[model samples]
Target: MKLRRDGESVYVRPMKLDDAEALYEMRTRNQDFFQTYEPIRQKLVMTLEDYRDRISDDIQHWRDQTGFTFGVFLQETNEFVGRVSLSNIVYGAWKNCTIGYFMDQAHNGKGYTTEAVSLAVDFALTDGQLHRVQAAVMPWNQASVRVVEKVGFRFEGLSKWYLQINGNWEDHNIYAITQEDWNK
Candidate 1:
């Protein structure tokens, strides 16, 4: 299932194996910059094959309804710009999902992430039919905070030591948008 949605400057779609090369390049180029915000997963540079394998798992996650990750690409140039995901989807009584994303450092402040977040939230609330979508950002990540805010996610509260990033527990400002909020 290759699902895609187009924005003026970019498109969001389920990443395919053939996209591995560009994805690998983007991740590698932004490796240092991304590490500051992301969790410490590994020390070695990930191989192209690793990205392919990861995409395979991500595709499975989509099919299983547990998560969905989309590659954000520059529409005009057809270049990889970033990745966004609605992960940890919960059904039944608690219909919700967690949204996460990262962009190549070179693409920062270009409205790509804001557009991607909007697309992801729209998909979760409208297409996926989830009740709520949430994003947690380190208090210092003002850029990310702005992204979610621009997408209409209201600040819910703060959680102390919510998640460990770079080996240390960090506080996160939680933000969310519910189905009702989306209807507005």
Candidate 2:
């Protein structure tokens, strides 16, 4: 869909096969930082070939209207900083999807993640024709909760053991914004 967003110092666009190496490095470098909030990676270090294959699969998913993943990069240097995704799409009567994102530990609290997510929500509601976009965050993950709240996702209470994160079933605080909410 060629979705892109340029912030004051960074930009967000779809992930490409050529981004395999940078993505790999970003994941590896942030392993410790992300481990607390993310599901446990099957591998400690993902090989470049494996990442390339994964990116290929992601491209196919994007083409098939199943999901979208975007890479966040520095505007001038093009340094890979993070990623955001809109997944679990369902059409028909639902027309909904879930959003998730992570940024480089060094880049936290800089507002880049908020900008990227805002752009994604706009694209999903307008261009992708989605009626709703949702996100869930671990109760302890204040940073993520702030991101969603900053983007105007309303609190929708908690889901017990909502997702398996860091190898354990964890409760999540669910939040969402509908197209109606966005239009207002």
Candidate number with greatest TM-score:
1
**Candidate 1 worst ten-residue window by lDDT:** 1-10
Candidate 1 versus the native: TM-score? Answer: 0.96
Off by over 4 Å in 1: none
Cα misplacement distance, residue 84 of candidate 2 (Å):
0.4
Kindly report which residue pairs in candidate 1 clash with one another. Answer: none
TM-score of each: 0.96, 0.95
What would the per-residue lDDT of candidate 1 be over residues 17-82, giving only the tens digit for each residue?
999999898898888898889789864678999999999999999889899899999999989899
Model 2 residue 169 lDDT? Answer: 100
Clashing pairs in 2: none
Q: Write the per-residue lDDT of candidate 2 for residues 34-146, one digit (tens) a residue.
A: 89888887777778898899889879988998998888888879999888899999999999999999898989999989988988888899888899999999989888888
Candidate 2, lDDT over the whole model: 0.89
RMSD (CA, angstroms), candidate 1: 1.3
Q: How far does residue 6 in candidate 2 sit from its true spot (Å)?
A: 2.6
